[model samples]
Target chain A: MFRTISNPWISLASRLILAAVFIYASIDKIAHPDLFAEVVHNYRILPIATENLFAMALPWIELGTGVLLLLGLLTRSAALLSAFMLIVFIAAIGAGLWRGIDITCGCFTVSSEGRQLGWLTLLEDVALLLPSFQLLLTAHPGISLDRRYLPASPLSAEPR
Target chain B: MKDWVAAHRGKATIAGAVLIVCVFGSIGLLRNAVAEHPLAWVAKPPVLVKYDRAVRPSPDALQTVTLEDAAGMAFDAGALFVDARTAEEYAAGHIQGAVNLPTNHYDDELPAVAARLEGMTLIVYCDGGACEASLQVARRLLKSGYAPVVVFTGGWPEWQGAGYPTEAGGTPSP
Candidate 1:
């Protein structure tokens, strides 16, 4: 049921979109680390100590994964990681809505976006999930280094 | 083991090992770096239970003032009027000489406010009628040691109805 994008142009487009999302997200968080930390705390998910650590590490993870994905380096690993992080975000947004907590999502906006714990945020995350899933499915597609660096044929059969 | 090592000797294995090391090491180092910066979007400093409880302003601390009371005062030269509404709401219209200090996230912004209005009689208000932002802000200010914080319960709407001096798109007149 999934559309496969084996074409080089399609693959490039997908990679670019994913990379742009990550890069933009990372820069925004990097600018206002403390506010992002508060957003994490508002989720009421992690312990206070770990919240800061996660906040710090997550954006850099995004940045690293984005760069790696853009370069088609370890495409599968990067896509999988991005997908997993998106899932966690969806869950957090869902829980926040269910609990009726009016909190500003530090997702995109630098300042408070007025605590819209609604379906919109959840839907936006789901939309992001689609591209990630696409990348994951076509993890080692022809255009990637996975296909270039690692030969398609078995290495063991090659004569020394 | 010797045969396996000899057969597997290639650039592929080295590249794979290097990639793994780099990814894992980068993750560790990134975690350490983030722990130091503590970005607000990702995580926030813990809200101490004691401080949270202590900081919550008492309801009675806010003194609700009537329009007449506000009008009667001979504009105490040192009195500072604060509009505890959103900037948009304040911009649409507000009591003349009132500064905007929206109540949402007041805890984060109050310290800066306290610094500015030190030793000034602060009058806080929101929209007329049942608006609580003014009272909430007034209580918070009182908690922060702002003396004589008066809440104009009859807010901007009332001030406008009384034909009081009003301004738009600029700082209010004293």
Candidate 2:
């Protein structure tokens, strides 16, 4: 549904939720860098050196995008980035499942002890994708900093 | 209806769709290109260290080792058999030659056990399939540079079933 948002509050709430998810996920991974690296390794994706780099950098990217989304600054850009990340995650999980490699998804945690990539992980990613897509499709909410710093209409336009 | 057509007709939905396709398609292509390289991020196995160094024999290591073949290998004359179960279980019964290594405290006391069984084949075992202490103990032995670590994967269950010589209580006589 591409219909424009008539209610800005709904849009703002959704943006917050999306941002919170990204920020929360990033913090957990940051806390356990080594374990996260192992999880990334379990995916069997990426060169050895690159896996370490990704394990170090990807969480920050997620955190940055999330903060932007929460602030509603460049909302569309943040949503797009989040969507791209989620899509990549889903694809990786799907590939792991297809190959029958039992490993942790590492989206949430880096530990391989109890985690397993399966249908449920894919579903969670898809759920995150929906809210991100919604933010992308709707206009920036009026309550956001985007509205404050860069109003949709020209600054000279008569105040509503 | 007429007003709607007039407003929407020039929006060029097809061009928009094509632009979306091109962007996503290019991204997909780029991803594929990176993935195709053997050195791509996803191509390598994760690095990890093994806790044990017994060097698990590869499937192709010997091709096959039948009971007769196993028997043919020189048994270490002075090697001691170490049972890694609890004392109570050890008291109930155990392999005739096995001394209690009791893996529950295996980590802390392995050195002492090893010293007693110095220059001996430390065959380690636990209850059975569900037991991991045997493997843990075996790993410890290997780490300590104990030679020729043999793990009876089937452990006590197999030993008892095979009707091998067994004994009860404190350290059976050699």
Candidate 3:
């Protein structure tokens, strides 16, 4: 069971899935930074001073992570970041729910009236964390740029 | 020594993630700086309120209202709520006591409703967040001789989200 769970194919699949999710999530946000800023503010989690900075930077980070995972370059690193982001998302959604903040999830869409922030949104983030953890744990760069470019890297050095 | 490797097993990966964040974050900031309209460093609430000077007959003639002010005025007998959303939306829900005055139907409805609006403060609103129907209606009201017209920029979403007074599926309460 452990070997199957840690299989190279499984790791590759996880990386690709997370990559698509991140890339799709980043597009609207990058195009509409001002609206995205408003969405981030609606969460009311971050300090007001930091909201715009966070809104501007986060989508790009997701885009970068997505591209890296898509290419399977720095697979472990991208996976780690993906997991970290999911944790933050889960927490933010949880906080929003706790405070009864009736807001759109601002997950895939930064639109004002998109998906409402709720337990289902929290669950979706939590489920994405599974694939992120799989990629992080497996670190199996199957047919990947990481395998070709970082041959001597510690993660790639493990016996197949 | 072996324990240290275990402790810092993914240190390089962590560093790589940090580097990716810094690199991409810098790119985002740079792109934002050079963009035509740079995003504000501090995000304000999603209220894009601009009281058009050209449309205003007088400086104090047109005004904007926050949710708190609108809420306070809701109870005032002299203040009347006018919802500028479509009639269907108005039927779905609206601020309690607000009259349905759909922007599209303004010409047909205004003549009938204008006389009833005399000697009262008009608090106009729509669906909010970039929906300018309220502004359009408010401007028309100003032209029609309604004084002290206040546009609730936050509008219905903000009011509904805040759990303020609202009603549905009826002609607006008197």
Candidate 4:
């Protein structure tokens, strides 16, 4: 399974799906940063001083990474970033559940209407996170903008 | 592992962080530079709220009411009690004179409450201290011109726990 995922075609498919999910998740947060910030506050994880900064800045980071990943520009770095974020999200969700903080998941929206954190949300993040982590570890150089524009560095060159 | 770091992780991590900062930070700063106020990331809540006449009252604006206080105010026509739990939760049971204005659905419910609730001391509450719906709803109400509004931090559970006045179903008592 691990070797199969590292195959270029499989990697490309996984990349596209993961990029789409991130891009989709980012739009609501970017559009409603204030609400998103409020949702972050509800989690009671970050201190009050940092909530606004994280909410305002994170969507853009997600958006940038998603776009780059979609274009296969800076593929490995984007994969690493997205994987790191997923891990953080997993931790946040787990913390909220452990502490029994009943708040909106804020995974997809700024609204607390119906999206509360639970075991299912945790499972979903883990499922999604695996591909991102796999992409980073495998680091496949496929049909990518990074491949097209920037060729191999001397470090990546094969020794005879 | 060491070889991979020398090849990949070393430059990539720095590049990613720098890229996010330079791009997003500039956009957020630019938006704040032109808008009515700095956007959330740059705007300190205290600074923004320092001298502004409150649109809604904070919990600190007045003492949080106890079951006794709420019971006494329940009969007053001018005392506005707001339940900040969900409609379903409110429907299940709430303080007798309180109306639902859940944080989740505040935008939908605000106009009606705002128009009719002027001159009333709005007392917002939810499912007790662990619930933030009340706090969020209270802030929105303040922003929407609900003055003298204060939170009852001990919300429904506290009121119910004390066997204070409560009624079930969606409608508020007249």
Chain A: TM-score in each model? 0.82, 0.86, 0.94, 0.90
Q: Using DockQ as the measure, which candidate wins?
A: 3
Q: On residues B1-174, what C-alpha lDDT tens digit does candidate 2 reach at each position? A: 434423442232223323333454344334334442212334233222222334564321211122222222225465566777776688899877677776435555566555667776566777766455566466557657776565655677876876766788765665
What DockQ values do the models have?
Answer: 0.16, 0.09, 0.50, 0.41
Per-model CA lDDT versus the true structure = 0.64, 0.61, 0.80, 0.72
Winner on DockQ between 2 and 4 is: 4
Arrange candidates by lDDT, descending.
Answer: 3, 4, 1, 2
Residue A21 error, candidate 1, Å:
1.0
| Model 1 misplacement above 4 A | A1-8, A113-117, A139-142, A151-160, B1-86, B89-98, B101-173
Interface RMSD of each: 7.5, 12.0, 5.3, 4.5
Best by lDDT: 3
Candidate 4 lDDT, B109-165, residue by residue in tens: 877666557888788889886676777787777777667666777788888998877
Window of ten residues with lowest summed lDDT in model 3 chain A = A151-160
Off by over 4 Å in 4: A1-3, A153-160, B1-10, B25-29, B32-63
What shift in Å separates residue B5 of candidate 4 from its native position after superposition?
Answer: 11
Better of 1 and 2 by TM-score: 1
lDDT of 3 by residue, B11-114 (tens): 86787789899999998999899988897766543233444434644432447888888898888899899998877688999998888887646767887677
* Candidate with better TM-score, 1 vs 3: 3
Residue pairs in candidate 3 whose N, alpha carbon or C atoms collide under 3 angstroms:
none
Q: B1-174 in candidate 1: lDDT tens per residue?
A: 435544554434344334544564466445556565333333323121211212543444445567876775527677777888777777888777777777655667666556557888687878767555676577668767787677777888888888988878645553
Q: What is the TM-score of each candidate against the true structure?
A: 0.57, 0.50, 0.68, 0.84
